[model samples]
Target: MDATIAALEELTPVSSSFAPIDDSAYIRFARTSPGTRTPVLIFNAIGVSSELFLPLSLSLVAAGHSVVLWEYGRVGDDGDTFFSRVQSYKALLGHLRAGLYDLGLEDCHAVTLCNGASVLARLQAELPFAVSRAALISPYFNLLHVPHQSPYETALVPLLMKAATDEGGAARFVHSVLNRGGHAVASKEALSKAHMASPRSIAGYSRMLRDYRRHDETDVLRRVKGELHAFYCLDDEAVSTDYLEAIRSAKPSIGLSTYAGGGHYGIVDNPSLLADVTAYLGGDR
Candidate 1:
């Protein structure tokens, strides 16, 4: 992980270089190989900050792909800010287009997970020319049945946010969320390393889940014209595999893959899942 830390630290200076076009948050992207021209755009899940995608992004970069990871301010904090939400999506789409243009990319592949899948689908429907293929990882289209901010969860968010902002709060929060719960997949050591790498980003993450709920993504998914890959975890506590299957059934052309054991955050803990994803993205069966 020392190499990852070095790469991230070297990237710190370039963090603020990608300015936002409007109210949307600007993203910090790291390319492993500057000379490689493979362009890939990533839209991250709402509940987590873009930093969470870094591990996978770096892996893709190592495979000779230039990756762009999008950040959407604080997720649930913008619940009441409708204009900001719209502008954020618009700005993100703009950023994707501009990045492709600057890279001289004719077509690009995009990947999104959870709530991001819906966002990317909507963008693709609006501008079909920009995206060539899409991959949705453990997508959450509806929140009604999915695990969401119950009264207890809602109350815990602010407290967690407060603690996450305090010194060593990130470590405390990750331990409480991932280790104490029977659902935790990552070891304390891994969580500790992640916390040290991106501390303050957790506050933004907690706020993203403040007013979180689920909604339908069928409409957006139907409009996406590119080759689609939908990957889901059967053990996911937040979303049901039935829903994912329904999406696959509804879209005959869309390809589906299921991982039986990984929980919602399996994508983080399972290297094989990333390998499968990389193969799919590379047009391998």
Candidate 2:
């Protein structure tokens, strides 16, 4: 366990340069191998910061792929930024594109999870650089069609914020949401990492949730020129089989894989999933 932690910590250190794209946005991303042309760009799940992606980033690096981890500014804090979904997406996407250029990365492969996939699917036609391949893990492309949550969930926002502020509440909440809740220490650690995101950004995520729309899947898929690899987890609560079927119908050419038991967060640490991603990035797909 100590060795694993050490390895993840060593993936990208603070000594690496973090470039700022604008006053409201910055990206702390670095390429593991400068000469390696095919970079793996990670589109982290919304509401969760880039820090939580360290383990997966480290694993990808170990498998001989350059990785890019990124996040954007918080909303409602900047008058220049509005509380719109497109505004949020533009911010994150802009920062990442600028950061990649600054880091001398192009012709990359992208790996996205959950809402990140949704954003990527919508912006597939607008990417600044060429993409060789793209992988979607438990992609929740149809956010509007997902099973509805309790209406009371919004009312409990204050309580949820309170829970996130305390260690025990945060742990319980993380454990409950994650597929691998049995790992208590990991759950707590994840909670700690999530706190790295600013409150304004978190609030913006809530706003995004309230205002999300279902994009035209067929049209979006038609715009994507790169090879697509999609993974669906058997135990993911956030994404359903219907979602997968919808995507399959829209983009039949996409390479699809399913895991028996990796909830949304499980794939982040699953060795087989990491290996598959590495293979795809390495053009073995």
Candidate 3:
């Protein structure tokens, strides 16, 4: 356990980076190894933050793949996200797309859990950079139950939407609700006091939830250029397992795996699921 904690602390001494992706977005690159081996890019889950990817990131980087972990200004604040710089989600996406193109990271394998899956799927396909392989873990693609949301979402999101008018206050409230009841502690208080006190640039993260659910699954899949792998944790509360059928129907050829256990962020604690995901992203599969 000591060794594991040491590894996590060592890989990303800082949970997030201050270097702005744009006026509002930021990335938490745990480790960067530029090499001939294909690189890996992990997308950020909404409230979970990119910090949760540390265990997975540590494994991937140790396997010799350059790994970049990123998160945008979403409706939640785990102390890692900068709500102050948030523009609309569309603007942040544009910033990331531009940055990826500038760095020539066009062929990287991409992995995302929850709402991050939506954004990764939305990246413009016309760009020279094409995602080689994508692994969607407990994906929260909202297109499922198209006529309505799953039970969990129905109970919680409306309240959040109503509260988004107060940016900073809403961020904390949303964060508290999405903290998985503290089931996942990797997103511990890692933000600096100064960073926390930084002035916010946005009026509020009012459009975030709407932005995630607006993408078309089929269209997003059409844009991806490689094999797609999805991990469905049957117990995930933020996103239900029912979405699997919707995703499967959208892309019948896409690979699928299911686990009856594990929370929304449970992949970190469930070593089997962790290894399975690592093999897929690390190309051992």
What TM-score goes with each of the models? 0.63, 0.69, 0.75
Across 173-268, the per-residue lDDT of candidate 3 in tens digits comes to 554554435533323433111122221212234345545555556666555568888887777766655566776677776788878777666567
- C-alpha lDDT (0 to 100) for residue 66 of candidate 3: 73
In order, what lDDT does every prediction score?
Answer: 0.54, 0.56, 0.59
- Candidate 3 runs further than 4 Å off: 1-31, 73-81, 124-126, 144-151, 166-203, 214-218
What's model 3's overall lDDT?
Answer: 0.59
User: Which residue runs does candidate 1 get wrong by more than 4 Å?
Assistant: 1-16, 21-37, 73-106, 126-129, 143-215
Model 2: weakest 10-residue lDDT segment is 75-84
* Model 2 lDDT tens row, 1-285: 223334545754322456565554444554455424466877776655555566667767766666766544332232222222333454555555555566655677888877677666665566667777888887755434444332222334333444433435543453344324454222345433442233433344444443444243456555666788887666665556666667666778778887786666655646677677667767776
Q: Which rank order by lDDT, best down to worst?
A: 3, 2, 1
Worst 10 residues of 1 by lDDT: 75-84
What's the ranking of the predictions by TM-score, best on top? 3, 2, 1
